[model samples]
Target: MSVMELLASRRTYRRFEQKAVPQDVVEDIIEALRLSSCGANRQAVRLVVVNRPEDVARVQPLVKWAAYLPPEQGTPKADELPTLYVAVMQDTSIPGDLATDTGIALANMTLAAWAKGVGSCIMGAINKPALTRLLGIEEPQKLAFMVAFGYPAHKAGIVPLTEQTGVKYYLDEHRDYCVPKRSREEIARYL
Candidate 1:
């Protein structure tokens, strides 16, 4: 698929099938993160892969799901949880903008996973202290975020925002996601 197509289809996936992403795909996702561009190439970002089922279960509760919808509508059930989690970290000892680097790494990793038919949710609303302890993250390494991954159980698609629709994403009658997006005319302009 074309890059634009990939970007359009790569929506945030919350509910996932109860299956592990292939080991090879996981490796590619990590490699994508490794190769992502960072501010001034400081490369302060790090990762902790949690592919083991037991570890994934332990990490699940520490991270929050979609905030736009109610818990029952947004949060994935036990059987719908992602089979893998990758903890994105920042090496505070290194000097650089952690937020920029983290965003680049997340984009690369999530796109790679999506290309291989694996879905991902980039989670930032989390219990940071507990996750740091659980993942054994030491000084100089701070938890930036966690991304959940697996084959998607539900479909999500972008919809152009209308007067009736707001910016917030919502679930359709089928529980699938409808992510409303602003039109280019509204959000961009020629100088």
Candidate 2:
């Protein structure tokens, strides 16, 4: 698919089909991230791809999902959990705030993953201290965020928003997901 189409269709996927993502595919995604725009060209980000069942399982509990949804609806069902995780880390050795760098790398990886029919959820609500220990990452390397990847199990649709309706993602009565986004006219002002 073209980049525009991919951007329009790519959604934050939390519920995933029970299937393993190939290691090479993960490698390709990381490779794309490696070449992504880095703040100051610091190249401080490091990604640890976890595809092994045991490691994926270990990483799952460290992540918290869907803050807008209730506990029951927010958490992925047992069979719907992602099979792979790309743990994005910041190498403090490079020296600088990594927010922009991390965002660029994640955007690249998520887009690349979606192009391959893989869906992802970039999670910031993580148990960082615990995850660092579990992953055996020490000083100078900090877990920034994680991107969960797998085939989507549920449908996510983008819906137009109104002033009265705040833009928060929610599940419809049928459990289908909807994300409300502001119109371009509301967000962009041409000179």
Overall lDDT per candidate, in order of appearance: 0.93, 0.88
Steric overlap count per candidate: 0, 0
Lowest-lDDT window of 10 residues in candidate 1?
160-169
Q: Write the per-residue lDDT of candidate 1 for residues 1-191, one digit (tens) a residue.
A: 88898999999999999987999998998899889998888899999999999999999989999999899999999889999999999999999889998999999999999999999999999999999999999998999999999999999998999877888899999999999999999999999
Off by over 4 Å in 2: none
Candidate 1 Cα errors over 4 Å, as ranges: none
Query: lDDT at 158 for candidate 2?
Result: 89
Positional deviation of residue 126's Cα in model 2 after best superposition, in angstroms: 0.5
Q: Candidate 1 versus the native: TM-score?
A: 0.97
lDDT of 2 by residue, 1-191 (tens): 88899999999988999988877678779888889887778899898888889999998888999999997997898899999998899998897668888888999999888888899999999999998898888888889998899999888888988665588898988787898998899899999
Q: Choose the strongest candidate by TM-score.
A: 1
Residue 59 miss distance in model 2 (angstroms): 1.5
